[model samples]
Target: MSPLLDTLSNAVGAAHVLTHDDPGADLSAWEQDWRQRARGRALAVVRPGSTAEVAAVVRACAAAGVSIVPQGGNTGLVVGSVPDGSGTQVVLSLTRMNKVRAIDAANLTITVDAGCVLQAVQDAAEQAGFLFPLSLAAEGSCTIGGNLATNAGGTQVLRYGNARELCLGLEVVTAQGEVWHGLSGLRKDNTGYDLRDLFVGSEGTLGVITAATMKLYPLPAAQLTAWAAVPSLDAAVQLLGLAHQHLGAGLTGFEVMGQFALSLVAKHFPQQRVPLWDEHPYCVLLENSDNESEEHARAQFERLLETAFENGVVSDAVVAENLQQAHALWHIRESIPLAQAEEGLNIKHDISIPVSKIPAFCAETDALLQHEVPGVRLVNFGHLGDGNLHYNVQAPEGGDAKAFLRTMEERVNTLVFDAVARYDGSISAEHGVGSLKVDKLPGYKDPVALGLMRAVKQALDPHNTLNPGRVLSA
Candidate 1:
């Protein structure tokens, strides 16, 4: 065994460390991603069960001058979890540390180890008669550590906020093997610099997030789901304003999808029929919640729809009558990614602009792409409430997906990112600047901001040992 592997085995345990040549015990499901970007090999996969064990593993790696890649559920959209083919880095898998240490329902907080699966946390919250409202497509498998690492945003972000906002404190293990225990559930602590926020979205580059205390919300007593067909993106935006004004705090989610994107879902998932007008140009999935009767929530949703229709914002509408029907309506929205995957490989982008600028951004970018790359198939959809969109472009029919991707990836990214910058939007919204977007960051991010990121990274991980060559390249 290599000296480094032997040291890691001794630090954690012999059984906790699997050597590089052990074939890794089949990580196909864990290794692959929703996007199928690329994969890499690790020198060893270490499963540490506690914060102390994680610190020990990190100390060992730091002493050996070997790199460590911190991983959670491995469901990240970018290739952040997977190592490069060099096989020199150790994959520090935190799955074994999955545990809910404490749930202070009265305090409205839950302290959990980073390895705990998101769904498990949600289940724990539900059992406590509360709601951990971080909803995402990959919640079943994605881990809280990964969620915080990426600062994930989802449908509930409009109401509950993103992972960063939901987090109150964190327990991080720095590169030097020391645990920085900041897991305070206190809501008001003007103690000092907000160190927790730095590591929350650092993507494991600055330090290893061992555990966290996340905020919880009161469970909603009622939920209303509606599907509305809008004549145009402008109408969809107008509808959103109306809902906000009328529904106020009850308005939770507002998702807008172009007709073409919805058509793909209908085509791929035939079981999920179109929810609104068959030939509408755009569709909006609106969700509302109230702490009162379901009938009251439904009535409020109906009022919003009625106002939208009267104002010429909504051409048609359908309100879900039951939970099953509500899920079916949401299924159409969630199935967009699955449907796109079934169709073919495409250049995908996660971008966000001002909520009001979305209509113009979509219109201008669509025209530019069509004019630049003839026959480009566009699939655009996402949370309009937060101004983030998944802008994807599939290769023309009969074109080679892989070959097209290889030749046009850079050019395509430039097109989308340039347009995003023009609108003062971000190239990365929910999906982070994992290894994929690290190269493109410097151009988009301010020099001062980038420099400060580098400085923080240097202060926490001077040796560039933790998740090296990711987020901020070495």
Candidate 2:
């Protein structure tokens, strides 16, 4: 046996280590990303059961000068969790360590192993009469480690914040195979470095996050959801201002969808039938949650909508009659991405701009795209409340989509990213700079910030043994 393989087998047992010969060893699901953009060969896929085991595996890899790619559920969109083309890198899968370490309902905190599925964590918190608000459509399959690695943002980010905000502490295994136990439920800790923050969004480049302690909130007593048709993106932003004035932070969700985006959902899922038939230029899916009763929440939402209508911000609106109806509305919003994917051959750009700049950004960018890439189909939608938009572009019908993408994908990306830059916004909104965006990081990211990132990476993983060529390229 190879010395490195022998050492890994000794560290985490032989059964947990799978080589190329094992059945399902290189299953496309694990080997490839969600978008099928990255698929790489690995020396072996290792499953370590505990922090100590992870540390030992890391130490062995470090000693052998082998790169380790920490993988969770492999649901990442940025090609972060998969191995590189090198046949020497090891795939460290955390699936075996899935467990709920602790749930302190009294403290409004739940400590869990990093491998636990996000939905499982939410279920545990709900079972304890609390709510873990880090939600995403991939919650059923995406692991907490992957979510923390990317600092995922979902529907609730408008209120509860993203993964970085929802997390209180983390137990990280650094590059040298040393475990740093910073998992505490304390709300306020004025520590020197705030190491927890560093590993949360490090994308497995700085360290391997073994476990985390996350904050929870009281389950909402009553929740309200609305599907409103707005005259334009400008009106949607204005309605958002009215919503803030009326509902304030009670507005837990404020999502926007363009006509084509919603139409795709309806077209893909004909069984659901389009809820609102109005062909408005834009739509806003807003959710309001409260500790008060259902009636109170409903009344508050009605007041906000009424005021919005009076001000001509909202063209039309509908309040979900029941929980099933609310889910139906949200399902439509969540289904847009899948619907787009099902349709095929589209370039997705997840960028963010200031809330105020969204209307102009959309108008200018849309105009530019139409002008430059003539006959381009645009699907514009995302968390407008939080300023992140999934600005995706599709080829004109019957125009050799793949060839168009091949010729124009880079140019489209340049246009979107340049617009993002022009508005002083981020090229990447919620997703981190995984291997997918490593090259683009140099141009859009500030040089000093990039330098500091490299410095920290050097300090943490001097050998570049953990997830090399990921977030901050070596």
Candidate 3:
């Protein structure tokens, strides 16, 4: 055994460490990512059951100059969890540390171990008669640690905000093997630099987030869902403004999808029939919640639709009658990605611009992409309220997806990112820049911001032992 592996074995015990040649184990799933585009080999996979064990493992890795990749659930899209194929790194799996340390319902907060699955936290909040509203399609499998690391944003961000806003505190294990116990339930703290914010979106480059204290909200008494067919992207944006103007903070989600994307879902998922008057170019899914009666909420949604219809903003609309019906509407919206996946391979970009510029951004980018790549299928859909668009390009008919991807990945990225830059948008909206986008970040990010990030990294991780080659390349 290598000296580093020997030292790790001593620190966390032999059972917690798996060697590179351990064919007896099935680690293929961990080796791949959610997108299956990034794959890597690791020297060993280490599972630590406690924060102390994590600290010890990091100390050992730092001493041996071995890079450590902190992974939770391995459900990330950016290949941040998996190390490079060089097989010189250790995969520190945090799955075994899943636990809810405490829940203070009165304080509207919950402190949970980083390995805790997001759904588990949601269930815990429900058991206490509260709501942990940070939701995503992958909540069932994605861990809270990964959520915090990426500063995850979801549908409800229009109301509750992103993971960073939802988080009140964090318990992180630093690169120097020191456990920073910053977990507090207080809603106000102005001592110094917001260290929690630093590690939340660091993608495991600064530290390993062991646990977090996240804010909770009161469970809304009623939810109203409406699917509206807008005449255009501009109309969709206008309707969103109307929703916010009338609904105020009650408006929870505003998701938009192009007709082509919805058609794919209807084709793939036969049960979810398309519910628009005609094949409109754009559709918006609007969700609202209130403490009053469902009848009142429904009436408010109907009023908005009525106003939109009269003003020619909405071409057609359908409001769900009950909770089950509302879920069905949401099902179609959530199934877009899966249906697209079944269609074929494509380049997926989660880019975001200011909410005001979304329409122009979409119109111009769609034209540019179609012009550049002949017969390209555009699947543009995402949280319109937050301006995050999953602009994906499907291969041409009967074309070899792998061959097309190999030929056009960089070209496609350049086109899309260039458009985002022109619109003052972000290359990565919700997802963090893992190993996949590290090389492309410099061109998009300001040099001063990048320099500050590097300084913070060096200050916290002088040895560059935690998640090396991710987020920033030294």
Candidate 4:
């Protein structure tokens, strides 16, 4: 252990290798997840400044027979990036390798280090007169590496696609400390196996993502946002179909929020002024990005809403007059998770059902949950355009929230995940199968699919040297 630590210290400066042995050294930021759901004890937190340094650290850990957990931003909801309590695993932190390697405007691609923040990448692209559209609430702190590792889907995924689709290439450090310099801006390459796709969503189990070349799009001439009051979940689904029909490729974002979910925001964050949530069972946030003028975008949104009203899918609606208003509306939608936290401890499930079957699935699942746990509250909201729902469960009013979570989390997860399986939906939509949901995969995932995944893991990292006990058991 001492020799390995010495080697790591030599590879990436002694200051980069953090350990409890260093006086006044605090590793809490690297140890605990943002949600506070997990806190790990790492043997050491190794910050590598370059891909070469990452490979060196991986080699050192592999030679010592010590497992490594690759982390970026430390903003992940699942306990995938943190080390276990054993205090024997090395945490390979990528935040130090933050850099924008290249931006080929003609090629419409932006290559960046895995440690580069998502927001920074967006800003870089914007500065160069382009748009990098992978966005979520955690963009401020989340890293591109982590985003690709999880194959994250955000608000713009309806038109732009997930991180995997946006990514054209990846620079990964294999488990054996070898560098795969596959980064490129090429859009078409039928040369062989798609290794980039394999590592994009592998969640650090297969290899360490050092950097990536992500797709970019031209900045829209006009971007308009609207919030509509929906009578029910079915109405929301109808409105979504209408949006696709009317807005066509112009539609970039379509988010659905249940009335209860908005109510939580109203109760916890009174300043944001939630709209039309009191009278409707659901409300949707829609975005239209047009290549034409702002007036054209506004007109398209108006036509969509008018049709929605005539069809009785939307009872009321409000379109943002400016960028500030648009951001405010988005802020309210993003505040759901925080508001839930302010209210109390809750069980969160990231699941996806076919767009057409969402309403029915929610109806059945809601009833089953209410019957099973009387008075349990459901917080439902997510990117409806992509069919992903952050269908979270909250404890009943005026009860021990912590106690509810302690005793009922497993039961609730089973109930929700079982329903997801019945609907032919995935239990994990954008959130990868971290240590939290690793065990749940067997029952929900197809036997053949699970076997194939296991085979891939064995083939990629046979000794489980990278992120062991993550997507699969060791």
Candidate 5:
């Protein structure tokens, strides 16, 4: 047996380590990203069952001068969790540490092992009569550790905030084989440096997050979802302002989609009929939740819609009558990416700007794209309330998707990112700066900020053995 393999086996047991030639060592999910754009070769895949085991495994790799890639769930979009093409890296899988240590209802927090799936955590919270609000479409497969590592933001981020905000404390295995047991579930810790926040979005470059304490909220009594067709993006922005004035915190979610994007969904999913038959150029999906009663929630939404229609900001509307209908409405919003994928491969962008600037940004960007990349199709929608958009582009119909990406992808990205910088926006909003965006970071990110990131990386993982070439390339 190889010395490194023997050491890993001794640390966590032989059954948990899988060499490339071992059974089920295809490394399909662990080595490749969700988009299948980034693939790598790994020496072996090791599963450690506890923080101690993880620390030991990390130590062994450090001593052997072998690099390590810490991975969980493997559902990340930016290829952040996957290793590079190099075959010398060892992947430390956290699936075996799937355990829920404690759920303190009185304190409104649940401390769980990093490998526990997001859906399981949410279910646990619901069963305990609370709500774990950090939700995503991949909740069934994505792990809390991966979510925190990426600082993921989903539909609920508009209200409950991102993974970083929901996380209270973390248990991490640092690069030098030391465990930082900062798992105190205190709401306020004023003692020192915010190491917890630093590691939350380090993308495993700093350390391996073993477990976390997550905040929970009281379950809402009712939720109302609506599909509204707007006259224009500007009109949608006006409606958003009205919602804030009228609904306040009760406005849980606000999403916007262009005509082309909505058409793609309806075309691919025949059963998900569009809300209204109209030549509307824009559509808005809004959700309002009430902690009191269904009647109260419905009344508020109806009043808001009434005002919107009276102002002629909304051209048409449909309110979901029940939970099943609400889910169906959301299904249309969630199915855009799937429909686009079925259509063909496209270049994807996750961007964020000020809520007030979103309308102007969209208008200017749409015109810019049309002029520069004529006939290219745009599939766009996003959390309008939080200023994040999944703005993607596909080759013109009857054109080659692959060839278009090859020739125009980088140029298109430059165009979009340059505009984003002009508008004071972020290049990566929800999806992180994984291997996909590593090269793009230096140009967009401030030089001093990049230097500080390097300093933090050096201090935490001095050997640069963990997730090499990820957020900040070595």
Candidate 6:
């Protein structure tokens, strides 16, 4: 063990090699997950400044028969990026490799180190007169490597697509410490096999993503936002249809929030001034990105809202008058999860159903959950345009939240996941199957599909050298 640590220290300067043995060295940031769901112990935390250093670390760990957990911002909710409690795995941190390698304006692509923050990429594109539409609430701290690893679908998935669709190429290090330089920003390439797709959403089980070349879009001329009060989830779905018909490709975002969810935001963060939540069962946030002009975008939004109101789909609505107002509206939408945390500990589900079946799914699941666990408060909200919902559950009012979770977490998950299967939906939509959902996947996921996944995992990481016990069991 000492020799291996010495080898790692030599490969990437000793200063970058942090260990639990060091006095006053705290590894909680890299050991714990974003949700605080599980904290693991790591033998060493290695921060490599370059791809070559990462490769060297991998080679040394492989020779020493040690598992490596590749980590980025440590903002993953599923506990995928952190190490286990064995205290033997190496935590490979990529934050030191932060750099925007190149921006090919002509090709509409930007190549960046895996450690680049998502917001930094977006800002770079904006500065270069382009748009990077992959956005999430955690963009401020989440790295592009983690985003692509989970195939993150954010607010703009309705128009731009998920992280998998936005990426053009990747630079990965195999389990054998070989680098695959696949960062060719070509839109069309008839390659033999699409290795890029294989690793994009692999969750680091297959390889380590060091850098990526992602697609970019032209900046919209005007982006207008609207907040609408809907009578029900069904009406919210109807409003979504109207938005697509009116805005078409310009419909960049359509988020749905339950009244209870909004109330939590208002109750926890009073300064947000959540609108249209008191009188309605749900409120929807819409975004229209137009290339023509703000006037045109406003007109389209107005027409959409007018038709929705006429069709009895909307009770009330308000369109942002300026950029500041638009950002304020978006801020409220992104603050739901944080507000939920502030309220108390809760169970979260990031499930996705077909657009047409979401209403029925929610109605049935809501009834089923209430019947199973009386007085359980539901915090339902997510990207309705893309059919993904963050259908979370809170404990009964004034009860012990921790005790409720300890006793009911398993039951609640089973009830919700069973309903998701009935609706032909996935148990996980945006978040990957980390250790939290790894065991549950076997029961819900198809046997044949699961077998294929295990086969791939064995082929790529036979030694289980990369992210052992994640996505697939070690």
How well does each candidate superpose onto the true structure, as a TM-score? 0.97, 0.98, 0.98, 0.99, 0.98, 0.99
Candidate 2, poorest ten consecutive residues by summed lDDT: 22-31
Report clashes for each candidate as comma-separated counts.
0, 0, 0, 0, 0, 0
lDDT of 1 at 50: 93
The lDDT ranking, best first, is 6, 4, 3, 5, 2, 1
* Candidate 1 accuracy as TM-score: 0.97
What lDDT does each candidate get?
0.89, 0.89, 0.90, 0.94, 0.90, 0.94
lDDT value, candidate 2, whole model: 0.89
lDDT per residue as tens, model 2, 149-213: 99999998999999999999999999999989889999899858788888878899989999999
In angstroms, what RMSD does candidate 5 have relative to the true structure? 1.2
Worst 10 residues of 6 by lDDT: 465-474
Residue lDDT tens for model 3, 86-136: 888999999998999999878999999999999999999999999999999
Runs in model 6 with CA error above 4 Å? Answer: none
As for candidate 3, its clashing pairs are none
349-368: candidate 6 lDDT, tens digit per residue: 99999989999999999999
Candidate 5 — what's its lDDT? 0.90
With candidate 5 superimposed using the best TM-score fit, by how many Å does residue 427's alpha carbon deviate from the native?
0.3
lDDT of 4 by residue, 385-416 (tens): 99999999999999999999999999999999
